[model samples]
Target chain A: MTAGGHTLQLFEQRFGALRRARRTESIMLFVILVLLFAVSAVWTDFSPTQILAGLPRIGEYFEKLFSIQPGRDTPPVAVLSWAHVLGGIKEPQSIAYWFYRLDVYAALLWQTVQMAILATVLGYSTAFALSFSAARTLTANRTVVFLTRRLLEVLRTIPQVVLAFIFVWPFGIGPLAGILAIAIHTTGALGKLFSELNENADLRPVEGIKSAGGSWLAQMRYGVVPQMLPGFLSYGLLRFEINVRSSTIIGFVGAGGVGQELKRVIGFNIYEEVSAICILILLIVIAIDLLSARLRHRLIGAL
Target chain B: MSASVTRHLPKIPLERRTLHWGIGAGAFAYFVYLLWLFDFDRIFTGLPKLWVIVRLMIDWTLFAEWDHAELIHSMAETVAMAFLGTFLATVLALPLGFMGARNIVPSPVFRFMTRRLFDGCRGLDQFIWALVFVRAVGLGPIAGILAIMVAETGILAKLFAEAIENIDTKQVDGIRSTGAGRLAELRFGVVPQILPVMISQALYSIESNSREATILGLVGAGGIGLRLSERIQINAWDQVAYVIVLILITVAAIDSLSKWLRLRLIGGPAARG
Candidate 1:
C-alpha cells in the first residue's frame, strides 16, 4: 500500500507538470498565431480601419447584386420576404430581372458547360491512353514512365488561362481556344491522377493476364482498366466541374462563354447584370456539384 | 467452348447495355456537332501563327532587356497575397465553422443557414469575387487578397464544419463532464481533433490561392498576372513567354515545397524519412 501510494504520487506530480507545460505551449501557439496575423496583415495591407470604412460601400456593392421590387418599401436585406426574394421573372426583385437577358446568358452557360464536357472528354481519353504506359507496375520501360510523369507535371503547372491565351492566337477567340486550353490542362491534371490511380490498382490481374499470354493491350483492358474505371470516371467528373469554371473565367480573356458577356457588362459598369450572371453561375454550379457529388458517392461507394 | 463463352460474357442487363450505348452515341454526336459549330477552319490556317508563337517563346532575348526587379516584386506579391488571404480566411472561418457545424451548434436551423451562406460564397467563381473586390477595395493586390480571403472562408468553413461534426462524441463528453464552459470544452475537446485537418486544408488553400491570385491580377487585382496581362494586351509574345517561364518556375517550386511541408505537417513519409 505504501509503495502504491508512492507511485501514484509520482504519477500525479509528472502529469501535473506535463499539463502546465501543455498550457504554456498553447499560450505560445496563440501568441505565434497573433504575431503571424500581424505580419501578414502588414504585408497584405489588410487594414481593419479601411475594411470597416469600406463595409458600407461593400454592402452597397452587394446590394446592387439585387434588384429592387417594383414597389417594395423594405430593404433588400430585410427578413423573410420570400416574395421579394423570389419575385416572378417579370418583377424587378426577381432573379429574372437582374438576369433579364436569360436567353443570352443561357446560351453562354450552355457553351461553357459544353466546353468543359468536351475538354474533359478529350483529356480523359488521352490520359487513359497514356496512364498504362505511365504506371510503374504496368510499364516495361522505367525511362518512359519518368518522361511521361515529368511531361504531365509540366503540363499541369501552367495555368489553363495561359494555355487559352496561346490557343486563342491559333484558334482565334472561340470555344475552340477555351476547349483546347482546358483540354491541355486536363490532360496534365487528369493524366497525373490517372497514373497515380493506376499505380495503386491491384496488380494481381495484370500478372494473371501476362501469365496467360495475353497481349499488352489485352492485359490492360482485362486487368487494370476494370479496377480503375470508377476512380478515373470520378476524377473526370470533378475535372469537368473545374473546367466549367475555368471556361467561364477564360472567357474574360475573350476565349469564349458567358464570362465574356460578364466582362462586357462589367466593362460598361453594368454591375447588376454581372451579378445576375454570377448568381446564375452560382445556381448552376451548385446544382451540378450537388448532383455530381451524389453520383460520385454512389459510384465510388459501390466499389 | 459454350461454357467458356458464357463465363467470359458480360453480365449487364440488355436494357442497361443499350441505354449505355445510346447515351454514349448521343453524347458523341452532340460533341461532334459542337466541334463542327466551333469553326475549325482557323486551325488549319493558323498553323503559321502557332509556329510564330513557338518561336517567340523560345527566344531568350526577351528577358535580357526587361525590368527584372519589377518582375521579382510582382512574384513576391503573388506569394504574399496567397499567404495572407489564406491565413485571414482560415481565421474568419474558425468561428463560422463552429456555428455551421451541426455537432457544435446543435441547432439545425442555425447550422443550415450558416452553411447556406457559405455555399453562396463558394458557388460563385473565384474571379467573380475578385472582380467584386476590385470594385469594392479598388484595383490592387489588396483586392486580390480580400477576394481570396472571402472565397476561401466559404470553402474552409464547410470543410472545418465537416471535420468538427465528425469528431467522436465520447471525447467531448469527457470535457463536458468536468463542468467546463463552452470555450474550455472547445479548447479541450474540439480543437485537438480537428487541428491537423484545419492546418492541412489551410496549407492546401495557400497553394491553390497562389494560382488563383495570379489570375486575379489579370482583372487589375494585382500580381504577376498584371504583368502577363499587360504584355498579352500589347501582343508581346516574347515578354509573355518570359512571364510564363517565371510563373512555371514559381508554381513548380511552391508545389514541391508545399508537398514537403504538407507531409511534414501530417507526420507522413517526409517526416519519417
Candidate 2:
C-alpha cells in the first residue's frame, strides 16, 4: 500500500503542511509582538513596586468605609455606616452616604433600557427604507445611493460618546440626548447591514415584480423587504444588546444612566462600590447578549 | 376547470398594511420638540466666538506654556495605549473566537459556554474595566491597556467568531477529507479566508480604541484625555478645542491609513463592500 493510505500518516502530513512557518516570517511576527509589548510597558506607569505599594491604600480605603472621617485624618472620606459597609457594598460612601440612593441606579438603568429599545426600533426601520435605495439591484439611482451611503459613513465615523456630548448641549442632560445618540448610530450601522442584505437578496422575485409592472415602492414591498427582514431583525437584535452597554457610558455626559453614577463613584474614589456597579453592569451585558443571540437565532429560524 | 369554479375562488386577505407609522410619528415629534428646546439662538451666538476658542485649543495642545512637552508625551502615550490594547485584544480573541464559532467547534454546549464567557468579558465598558484595573494595579496606562484589552476582547471575539462561522465550509471539509486534523483544516482552509477580514477588523478596533483610550484617561488612566479634562475643569474652552483638534487629526489620519491598507490588502470593491 502507498504510504498515504495510513490515516495517521495523512493527518501528520496535513498538520505538517499547516504548521510549516517560514523562519523569517516567524521571526518578524515575534519581533512585532515583542515591540507591542514593550510599547505597552513603556507607556504604562505600572511597576511591580507600585502595585505592591497601592495595596495598603486599597486596604485603608476599605477601612475608612466603616467609619465617617475627614479626608486627611484617614484616606478619603468614609461615607457608609458599619452595617452596609460590612455587607460588602462597594463604594458605600457613594451609595449609602448620599441617602440610600440605589433608586437612582435603578431609575438610570430603566432610562438606558428604554432609550436603547426605542432607538434600535427606530434605527432598524429607517435602515430598512434607506437600504432599498442603496442596494444596486433594488434601485437605479446611483447618486442617491452613493449620497446616502456616504451620509451613513459620516454619521458612524463620529464616535457615539462625542455625539452624546454634542447632543447634550442641544437636548439637555437627559435620556433624550442619549436616545438620539444611539438612534443616529443605529441608523448608520443598520443601514449598512440592510444594504448588504438587500444586495445579496435573490433577484428572481424583484425581476418578476418589475416585469409585472410594479412601481419602485411596490417592488420593494413585494420583493425586497420580505427577503431582507430576517437579516435586519438579526442585526437589530445585536445592536440592541450593544446600545444597552453603550447607553450606560453615554450617561457619563449627563445623559442619565448608570454611567453618571459610575463617574460620581470614580471621582470620589469609591472603589468598592465601583466594583459592585461594574459587576452589576457586566451581568446585565452578558444576560442581554445571550438573550439577544437566542432571540435572533429563533427569529431567523422561524422565518 | 369550469368557469363557475374559477369565479368562485376564495378571497385572500390583502397584504397586511401594518407600517411602523406610530414609531415614525413619535420620532418626528420628538425631533421637533428637541430642536425647539435647543434654542438655536444660543448656539448661533456661540458660533462666532468658536474661532477664538479654536485658537486657544491649538495653543493648549501644541504650544502650551506649563507643559508643552508633557502634552506631546501624553498624546504619544494615548496612541501607544490604543495600539497595545487593540493588539492584545486581537491576539487573545483569535483562539477564543475559533472555539466560540458554531461551525468551528460543532459542539453546541461548548460553543454556548464559550460564547457567554466572551460576552461576560466584553460586556462592561472599557471605563468600568479601567476603574477595576486601576484599583487592582493602581492608576496608570497599564490599567488603561488592560481595561481596553479585556473589554474589546469580547467584541472582537464575537465578530471574529461570526466571520469564521460565515466562511465556506466546503474548503474546510475538503481538507478534512484529505485526512487533515481539525487544526490543520483550520490553518489551511479557514485562516487564509478570514485573515484579511481579521486584519481589517483589527485596524478598525485600533481606531475605535484610540477614541476610547482618551476617555479612559479622564478617570486618571493616563493619556491626553487626562490633560483635556484638566483644561475643561478650568473652563479652558480654547484648550479644549486644541485637544479636540489634535484628537481629530490623529483619528482622521489613522482612519485614512486603515482604509488605504484595507484596499491594498483586498481588491477595492471587495475590500470596501
DockQ, prediction 1:
0.57
lDDT of 2 by residue, A1-303 (tens): 676579778898887775564444557767986886686666765355765776686676566545555545665544454565544435444444433455666666666776777767667778777878778767788899899888777656556665566556545677666777778888887888888889999988888989988888888898887887888888889999988988878887786678888878877876555656666677777778889999999999999
Over 4 Å off in model 1, which ranges? Answer: A1-39, A62-96, A297-303, B1-20, B268-273
lDDT of 1 by residue, A18-95 (tens): 778767766876797688677666765777776676568777765655545334685554222577657777666455
How far is each candidate from the true structure, as Cα RMSD in Å?
4.1, 8.3
lDDT of 2 at B25: 82
Q: What is the TM-score of chain B in candidate 2?
A: 0.77
Instruction: Please identify model 2 stretches exceeding 4 Å from their true place.
Output: A1-21, A36-102, A270-272, B1-76, B89-119, B134-140, B153-208, B224-273
**Separate clash counts for every candidate:** 0, 7
TM-score of chain B of each: 0.91, 0.77
Provide the TM-score of chain A alone for each candidate, in the order shown: 0.84, 0.77
Clashing pairs in 2: A90-A272, A90-A273, A91-A272, A91-A273, B56-B238, B57-B238, B57-B242
State every prediction's TM-score relative to the real structure. 0.89, 0.66
Q: Tell me the TM-score of model 2.
A: 0.66
